[model samples]
Every structure is written in structure tokens, then in C-alpha cells.
Target: MKKFWLSLLSIIIPASAVTFEDNDTVVLLGNTVIERAQKYGYLETAINLSARKKKLKFRNLGWSGDTVFGHARSYFGPPKEGFDRLKSDLTELKPNVVIVCYGAVAAYDGQKGLPEFLAGYETLLSMIKSSASPREIVIVSPPPAESLGAPMPDMREHNKRLALYSKAVGKLAQKHKLQFADFFTTLGESKGLTDNGLHFTPEGYQTAAPKLVEALGLSLATGNQLQSEHARKLREATVAKNKLFFFRWRPANETYLRLFRKHEQGNNLKELPMFDPLIADAEKQIEALKKTTLSLK
Candidate 1:
């Protein structure tokens, strides 16, 4: 009985210390945008769907209601469960990329603004870059919220700040050479947002997912391995919505997005196998993606 108890302690202690370590993981961090209530960030469903649709392995690490600015309080130090979870994710998961969607939770706090947000966010990126498992970091701006809802004044002002906020996001990404995504701009106005006007509608996700893949440098056709493993988990989960036309791809024609579309529609995989050597080269990468999403509990 004593030995069994000792062995249990040995296992439990290390389990408590476990840190995420898969390199291909795409860690999604944020508040309600990524909570179970909202279905893993409004963008998660589609991105996860994209992972499965393209057969990419993927994992999710988002906590609902976590304001990025507030995460330190909610996630670590005195030890907010979410913060503890995030530390575990960073120490053990070791994802290839960590995409963060935050700010909305703090939008009403009246303290954080574009510059303050940028400075604080830069620190977070610097920490990740300096950490044991340096990763590809992606910054996502908060989506626009309903104008007349809870904390009514704050919500009304939120959309007005989108452009200003997006500029900061762009500048920060430029400074750090990271990818930037504006859920606000992407899902703004014409996208048919929810009644609340902030949370995206099912249609909103369909609109946002492909663009996220483009911004994150995932092959639309091939998929980014950053989100791997859970591809088959929700293959049949479909939500209905209207399709909205989007603005043209600006700046770089972006090979990742372009190549992805081709891969998505291609149907000659069997014939390609005839070029076994080339196929082997391509598959080495696909196999690598599989390893990224394999761990995350």
C-alpha cells in the first residue's frame, strides 16, 4: 500500500508539471472568443474544420473570457487556473505557432488602448521568442462587438476603435515579423455578425476561416500543421450561413494562399504517387504536421 501510494505521487507530481511540447501546434489564446461557450473563438470552428477538411492535425488551447491584458492575473502568478493552463501549454506543448485573439475582454476596462496594447503584446511575443520553444506568433485583433449591448458605451466605442487597433496590430506584426489578423475588419459590417453584433455568426466563421489560413501561412489546400491531429474530430459538424464576397488579396499575392486553393481542389493524388520520390518529399512534411497536434490535454 505504501509503495502504490508512492508511485501515484511520482506520477501525479510530474503530471502536474507537464508542459506542452509539440512543435507544429497552433495555440489559440484569448477570452470568450475562444471559450467553449462561443465554440473556441468564433474562428475556431472553421479553422478546425479547415484542418480536418485538409486532413491536417491540430489542437486548441483557448480559454473563454480571458482578456489578454488580464491573463497574467487569470492564468499565472497567484495562479489563475487559465494562466496555470497556459504555462503548462507553453512549457510542455511547445507549439510551432501561437495565435492570440484578445483585447475584447479588456476593451471595456478603459485602461488598455492601441499603443498600450501593442507594448504589452510585444512583451508577450518577446517572452515567447526568448522561451525554450521559440514559436511563430500570430496576433489577432479583437472582433467588433454589438454597438448597444452590455457595457453599452464601451461596446459602441469598440468598433470605432477597430481601425486604430488594427493599425497597431499591423505595426506590431511588422516590428516582430509576425502574422496579423483582424477579425474585426474581416467580420465587420457586411459579414452579418450575430445579434450582439460582436460575436460572429456561423456565416461569419465561414468567411473568416479561409482568410485566417491565408494570414497564418497555412496552405488552404495543404493546411498548416500548426493545427494538426484534430482534423477528423469534427468533419461532420456544419453550420449554415450566407456567403459574402471579400476584398482582393492585397500586397503580396501570397504563395501560401494561392498554393492552398490549388491543393484544395486537386484530385490527382493517386497519379502523383507515381513520382514516388517527389511524393516522398511532400509526405515528409505532412508527417511533420501530424506530430504538432498530437498532444494537448
Candidate 2:
């Protein structure tokens, strides 16, 4: 019985002792996109890269259906845990970079005009900035939502505000001289980086993590980069074959056709599935390619 208790303690001890290493706490704040990543995903890999240096830890504070600037912590409420932890979380981790993703919720029902939204957003940014003293921050543009399917009239209008809010965030990053991850521009190319219209899948994280990794200056060495370049082309060939399979199967490959259209931004580590099975299949192949490429080093 004593041996059993000691063994259990040994396992639980390390898990409990874990406090997300220093310098790279990588505080990710936003909506479900950030929240879902708590499970195994690319954000894990990105943190791993960041961790390779100064002991990285991922602190998730994503709240679903929150707005970028509507002061959600007050009215809309927060996750059971609350993003307010940013203050204490920062005090403890002193994150090297804070990546924020909170626009989708604010865009939802808030009748506030653009200026009001921006003001609310600015306050949030201020809170985040002040909390950490001098931690680096990255303003990630909220990915577009599938507002077309929502029943609420306001939900219909939310995406526009989210877009505008993203623009304002860009300005804030510039003003603060913080890192701006133009996830809007980079992710804007596809059907806005998601399949369910909102919420990321395994693939969405795959697409965004590398960009965030690069944004944080967590670049792999030149030797690794050179090897990655060669591996990338072989992966491209794999994608081309997947595209061929789609063309060969199903209704003139219309679904596959839509996949390319929706997943045009499929490169750059995107993991979201697209309009067709064929296209989605090709994406999976590409994903495998990325794993193999990254493994070379």
C-alpha cells in the first residue's frame, strides 16, 4: 500500500508541479479557437518550439462568443475561469508573448457602433498590456465567422464588426510596437480559416501555429530551413496526387473543386477541411507532408 501510494504520488507530483515553464508562457487569449487548442494540436507544437528555448508554457484564456471590444468580462460574462486571470497569470508567468483571439463574441449582439467597439477593445488591450508590465503581445485578427447561418439579426451583422475590430487591433499593435499577427490577412485568403464557420479543427491549428511561431521569431535554423524547402516540394507532389484522386472520383469533382476554392490558404500549416471531400483529402495529404518535412530536422 505504501509503495502504491508513493508511485501515485510520483506521477501526480510532476503533473502538479508543472507550471508552464518560464519566458515562454505564450498566453493565448481569445474565443473557442484558443480554447479548443488545450487538447493536443499544433498550438502544442508551436509552444514546443517556443519552449525549446526558455521553458514555454501555454496559458489559455479563450472565451467563446465574446466580442473583441464589448467588455465581455463585465456583461457577456467569461469562461468559468475568466480571462481576468491575465493579471495574475502574467504576474506569475510574465509571458514572452500574449496572443489574443476575442472578436467573434463581441461581434454577436452588441449594438455598439464601430467607435464604441474600438474603445472597448482598446480598454481590453490596455488591461492586457498593463497586467504584464513588459511582456510582448501579438494582436491576432479574429477569423471570420459563418454569420450567414445564424438566426439572430444581430448575429448577421456581427462579422462586420469583428472585421473592423481586427483593423483596430492592428492599429493598437503599431501604437504599442507589439507584434501584429495579421491572422486576418493571412487567414483571410481561405473561407476565413474554419469549416464549421467558427471553431477551429485540428487542421485550423495546423495552419495558424507555424505563422504564430514565425511571428514570435521562433525560427528554425538555416540548415533546418534548407532541408524543409526540399521536403516541401515532395509534399506538393503528394497534394497534386490527392487533387487528381478527387478529379477521378465523385460528381465531376465539384466538391473537390470547392475545396481548393475554400482551402486556397491550405498551405502555411492550415488544418481546416474545406467544401469537398476530395479537397479535404488532399489537405490531409498535405498535412502528412508537413509532419514529414518538419521531422527531417
Provide the TM-score for each candidate, comma-separated. 0.55, 0.54
lDDT of 2 by residue, 191-253 (tens): 434556676666666566665555444544332342255444533444354344323322243
Note the Cα lDDT for every prediction shown. 0.48, 0.52
- Highest lDDT: which candidate? 2
Those runs of model 1 whose alpha carbons end farther than 4 Å from true positions after fitting are 1-23, 36-56, 70-85, 109-112, 147-156, 201-203, 214-233, 236-297
What's the distance in Å from true for residue 158, model 2? Answer: 5.9
lDDT, model 1, position 89: 50
- Candidate RMSDs in order: 20.4, 18.7
lDDT tens string, model 1, 141-181?
Answer: 77666554465344556566655565556566667666666
